[model samples]
Target chain A: MPTTLRDEAAIAGIGQTPYSKNSGVSELALACQAVRGAIADAGIEPREVDGLVTFLMDSSDEVEVARSVGLGDLSLLSRVAYGGGAAVPIVQQAAMAVATGVCRHVVVYRALNGRSGQRMGQGVSGDIITSDLIHWSWYMPFGMLTPASWVAMAATRYMHEYGDCADALAQVAVVTRNHAQNNPAAAFYGKPLSLEEYYNSRWICEPLRLFDCCQETDGGCALLITSPERARDLQQRPAVIRGVSQASFDGQEQMTSFYRPDMHRLPEMERAGETAYAQSGLGPADMDAAILYDAFTPEVLMQLEAFGFCGPGEGADFVRDGALAAGGRLPTNTHGGLLSEAYIHGVNGVAEAVRLIRGVSHNQPERCEHVLVSSGVGVPTGALILGRDNG
Target chain B: MLTPEQKQDLETQIRAFVGRPTGPPSVGRDLVNEPMIRQWCDAIGDANPVYLDPEAAARSVHGGIVAPPMMLQAWILEGWSMHRGHGEPRDEQQRLHKILTDAGYTGVLGTDTEQTFTRYLRPGDQVSAETVIADISEEKATGVGVGYFITTRTTFCDAKGIELGTMNFRVLKFIPKEAPQSAAANADAADAQPQKPTRIKPPLSHDNAWWWRAVAEGTLLPLQRCAQCQKLRHPPRPMCDDCGATQWDHIAASGRGALHSYTVIHHPRFPGYEFPILAALVDLPEGCRIVSNVVDCEPGALRIGMALQAFIHEDEDGFKLPLFRPAEPA
Candidate 1:
């Protein structure tokens, strides 16, 4: 039988560049800066790092990043695809490398000038020949080109089946922005979103208003991973990787999985969540807080239900009355998530989870020992469980 | 603003046409045949073998070649020459248009349409259509100007009087909010402004060029069938993701579908598209879905699972794109 990877590795340090719409520098510079900061935070020499991992969509090459960070040699370097869904899996890969003794210290990072350089929300164009582009050609001719539009199709059907409306979605934005107010690193730090503001925001796609979408951010986030034994000697307290998983269902197709029978649910997420819980021997009831991916508000609602945080079709009810706020049942996305914080393809959420596990988060929960963090929703997704050393 | 008496008169004139047949029954110019079917398949880029290769179609449940169900209206559409009020005006639609035009509501635009298909059309079948006035709205302020909404329902049948489908089409006839500029002013404005670039067309590749050709030929809705698995698919691809079949064929759509889900785009307006664009994912009865624009209905009025029909919208570039509109009551 295969052994669970629970508690095998630990996240020793987390570092991030200030979230901004435009970094005014190359992605490589931002990547190097974040990697150097993470190594420094880990109290490990740059040459000590042996493994590096990131998303396949990331512009910076591993060798370039390694060279800039003054790393001598690397043994394992891997890239995961499916965009933000690679977040937790990247860390999982690093942890596996450490647990298996393939590499002593591994660094995982994601860097993008999403707003300053390549805006993803802008509809696809150019001469791209790939199977994915062929799939997109079906909808693009009808102007259903953007990510928001693709998700809206599923969201509308979800609303129809669940008796939920935009009000429930608005609550998510309000809660996320409210948390952003207290976190100085958040993009919308001082400006909190009101329910009225969320409702009044212009529609980017029907059923999804402007405020429901994540801000395209130009920044970088990096995390350092090593065996729990090594992390014990690091500068900061370690956030043990209790469990991690990546999931994709049989019928999954990027963002347009509309053909599935139950349009409202994220089956892939349910699988990932199940794997994480089984590996960690922890359920939703054991979690102190969570950072559900908030690329769009509807996704947060769907994730809440899919991860067994709530009963099916009751995600809207689960999020009511500041329940996800700082003092509520599960303080979700206490750093405001991608909605109000920087969207470093969800790497920032992982860093925030580490902060919560270390009890150093600005919006720290009262009893945050076991924190759950998720990657992108509406696609192949990933999740992680992080706990303090005592836990 | 109109006087009370004029308002009453206009309302009475518009209301009188209610419940009246809109036009005389019209027959198609040509019988359904293989060439027309092939031409339509080429135009719409459908490669459903059931529409082209008889031998492969014979093995399918459909038994033989059947016209796409969505082609019900297209079969009976009067060609371009007769589209702009040709022949003697006898129907209530003509009289209503005349009244609106005389009253300075000369500007007209199609708003929406709904369609329902009862059966697939076959080659050698002769189709005919008869229309009736459904409703006319009260004068209301709109983005373009003050206008009244006019709706009509058309029923399609074959030469033997067998019902095939029905279409509910609506349009807005209104006076422009801004007065028309003089010809010289228009010319000067045109000269002053750098020539606006043409709207971006869909990128055509080997896999999708046939669909664009169909659009140019005005056959807007088409479906693809995997030659190996015989499964229907859309957003045309060269291979079947299901059975891994590289061989495929095309079929015309029934043009009758329902709004599965939709989104009204309101940000980062792209050129050639109007604002608040209603993009929809339509579920076809043929067991496939398509993403297209839902036209002629208010964004607020759009609903998931609402019945819709297909219509061919001609862009400024003369590319006929398939769009959907809300279905009318039976």
Candidate 2:
């Protein structure tokens, strides 16, 4: 298959606010701060940005963010939905816009007061009535209300099918927290978690302990995308967007995709990963590191299988062999991921991918050339292949 | 901790009650009927047509209206009067409560419940239930207080004595820690004020109102059948995706299914719910799936592809909901 958008656009800059339980500011302010930081990092004027993309769930609008950041007229403005699943696709949208000349300079950002404000873990409130809630009613009556519970259904099935146990999921928390110990920005920076502690932690949902859930964090993250030709003239080495793709399969529901044929496998991620690899002409072997989404620890394992980092039902074995640690075959979520780092959706993972490609990550891998960044699992998801611009 | 003699005495006392009938088998005051079904449907906001629409019911696979399976317990609750200990303590439950109360464990709170249904109860069916003491746990420390978890198993049947369903309900009987007078007064004052309602019911909408109605009418596992292509879909929709047909009807699903996936929820406790609640995604024989609470089995015992049958679980507020349980071996 021919590569469609390979190396056509590059992530010229990455920026983020210090993630925390409470940012103590408006989401609009957070969006502006991250966008301004991205513009500054890319050595580009705010007025030069001609495109913007964000999640539909984000409070800040494109026009509002543009006004706040002093950007001029925009040529492309788009929003992706499905929560964290929108992370990589917004970048893919920006890269596509830039590559096709729909926009010259594009900025993708996500900002929310997820912790102090609306906690996603609180589940759905009654005031909002939508088609989605109508679908959720089928399960809500049974007390399967939260995202953790929603994903737990699949995670439990995965364990039952593979003969795996909670130990497999606990390893993810241990590994990510270990990485967080060295990163000051991580919420768990000072608190290292042990396997014993993981076992002792109370269950948020069975097969998923408290440690398996991501932090409810308040923060923002943004990325600057531009043509590869324009990136070479910028201040930093660009992480070329070698490939990007978004995908979803038939019978897909938001999180309660219980009707699908296979409960253990995330077909959407597999489709997105396959498309990204085909577009980049770089398979999993080419990736020196990965920044898989860790909204929940089990998702990271599932993504490992979906993205072909390991064979199907081999995720626990892969993690058990230390393949996700610093010196392992594929060091993942070196910044501790959402499990230990603050949850800024998966955009923070994207910033980490850029840092890896730029060779500036705090937990810098020995050889950082290509990094695979995945969006949300158990939803219509996306993936990105970012590579260092060696030339 | 109890002395060895006290432990033995307590064990013998608790063990003697095991396998004894908690109460004489009693029938509901009213046989299953449409008016009660309508009220239930309205209360729970289920709008499935097979429960409410005679025309729709005739065309569906069930061929007639059926009661929501979860109402098995509600049909034979013995009402609030019996529950408040208004009369003589004739039942084993009252005897057990008296035993616990005399021992200084006065407080009571329900801990968990599990139910399994053998078949749907239809209108005009006379329902009855028999209760028995299943287990009595030794004293355990809990966030509320030191308590014993008493589990009761109730078996429901029809007028012909054919088993319809079974429910296992557990409650924590505890001794409250002494409270300071001022704190107790404040708590009383707080309780005196009308508490803000914490229980959130499912948001009812136009497209799925029929589904809730069917649930109210006592139909188990109702799914929309596309009029054009005959495809069965759940989480009901306005139009059929397969044929793009706007016109559709519903079918009362076979309560039989398998545990496709499941989770045990333990955090951010919601009102009107028990902790460590087993939530499951059951794959119906019709090739669709529905999410419901899996009861009557240990959380550890839940496995993929385990056969399950539907049950109607009624909450403390008397709201009925569809649930599931592991199927008994043939």
Candidate 3:
């Protein structure tokens, strides 16, 4: 809860396996590979890891992952759900554990063959949510079915109140892709599109387009975390966990939030940003670069608005200056993000954030003081502010 | 043998029993019941904003996420918890039904159910359903009893208690000793067939909304419900052997029910019905089952879970239509 916690903890090492459209390995194998890579990157032995963390959406168990990665023992192992919202929060968990003496060194990894392996976004059907669908049977039978279809209603209404056209959403896809076009690791590398292309794209539900959604990728990313004193001795420049927070707002639904009073306000994101800032003792202007989650391009725009980079609808204008690339104000998704990068839920975004702070990113930004990262938007969200370990 | 007309008549009576009311509701709930709502949400998996976000719910035209329909499934299990199994842990259908109804609850025999979403439920929204007495009947049974059987009817009403859908169920009461001679035999035989449930699919079983195509006449859709929770569940399991039995029964339902409940949508989000189409819950008597959809009738008279007859009617788009018509008053 104290601001000191953020400034005191840092990323000791970061590692990522090759991004892929598909893989021959199991999810656990991918997880172990990423974990070992991170440990080796940190110059730490597997036995040194006292803690572990992963995404709840993953199929691999912690014990199984630890065993596969050759980790001797662990004092703590945890997982955070809420889809992409687990991104930064997992590191925060590792940091919290190390800070509290519950563990020494922590390894956090996310293995997602999210694209060819398990396409969470192909949309679901025929499943009975005794609670959600039973409740949904009351509503959905009336018409709400797919996740995008449900969220589109909210997007349409948001555009209505803000007086912005669907063009406002086009800025995000084009911008993130522009960054991805040059990053070889990106699935969409060299696959750039015009704003007109984004607008003319087919509708999944209503305002959303083909490019507006993220790529379903099969990849894994991992990080090694330790206390500031310990991290400085590691192999790579430690990206300190400057701040992290998770939030859920009142009246939040899974995806269908048709009853919201205001579409512009992502109260969950706002709450997370407020908590992160209060704990980190840093404001938005202090951030040097960010690796925002690009699950849906519009989500990034809304996140910019929530993180206080810009006010309300000004997110479109804030990034319109092309300042999100190298040598610009705060380059984002320099590793291509979920849109271009292999979708590992939000874990890949965390990996990119570390690269930004270490100046090792494929598309490294010019300035690097602080790096910002976020989890999934819409549902419950999480965020973190990472900085170089000064100690 | 039941003529198509006889089956229709029996279905009509079942609807009347479930849909008719006695007086005001014994209990009504609003969205503010967070503790209760939280219990319900965690029980299911409705993490959506339509159920949690206040600002979002307020923005939603419907106010908040309405409770999922299958939520009633919990009563079946909880009822057992109160009783701790039929005096000895044996699965007893009679005992399970009795305790549930004794707790001011009644369930429809769901031969088949389908839901289409135009809107989603949010948190802090007021949702209420009223259980009413719609009609009653008596029949001499040859399969395990020789006595009077009763059908109870009910409907879901909103905060204003607007009719949501009608639920009709058949409760068989025997002369106490004429039990089905082959109870264990029936259980074994039921297992031999192990009919797959038409309601649930793989991976995510609890959130199965649009899982099945419309059924053909002579087609049987297995009654589905959750494993953890029992009541009128959709994804079926013996632990939740919906009617409270370790023994799963594949009852070959007559599949003909009168329109016990009906509604005409002014919108398309409801799934099958577009352009002011009709939808309602029908009561099937043989299996004592119930299901919903548009039926052949004037929209105006399709009052409160009314008893209209049903048959399989699939649209050209490959959606089987659960068509129904009003039956003569019981």
Q: Report the C-alpha lDDT of model 3 over A143-204, residue by residue, as the tens digit.
A: 33445544554554455455554565676677777778778878888788797787777655
DockQ of the candidate models in sequence: 0.33, 0.48, 0.03
Q: Rank the candidates by lDDT, best first.
A: 2, 1, 3
- Poorly placed runs, candidate 2 (over 4 Å): A1-3, B1-199, B316-318
Tell me how candidate 2 scores on lDDT. Answer: 0.86
Q: Estimate each model's TM-score.
A: 0.72, 0.73, 0.56
Off by over 4 Å in 3: A1-4, A125-143, B1-330
Best by DockQ: 2
* Alpha carbon lDDT at B80, candidate 2: 64
Model 1 / residue A249 / CA error / Å: 1.6
- The candidate with the higher lDDT, 2 or 3, is 2
Query: Candidate 1 residues B62-165, lDDT tens each?
Result: 88899987777778877785544423445678778777766767556677899999988888899998999989998877666687899999998888898888
Residue B125, model 3: lDDT of: 38
CA RMSD per model (angstroms): 21.7, 19.8, 26.5
Q: If the candidates were sorted by their TM-score against the true structure, best first, what order would they fall in? A: 2, 1, 3
Look at candidate 1 and tell me the lDDT of residue A248: 94
Total clashes for model 1: 16
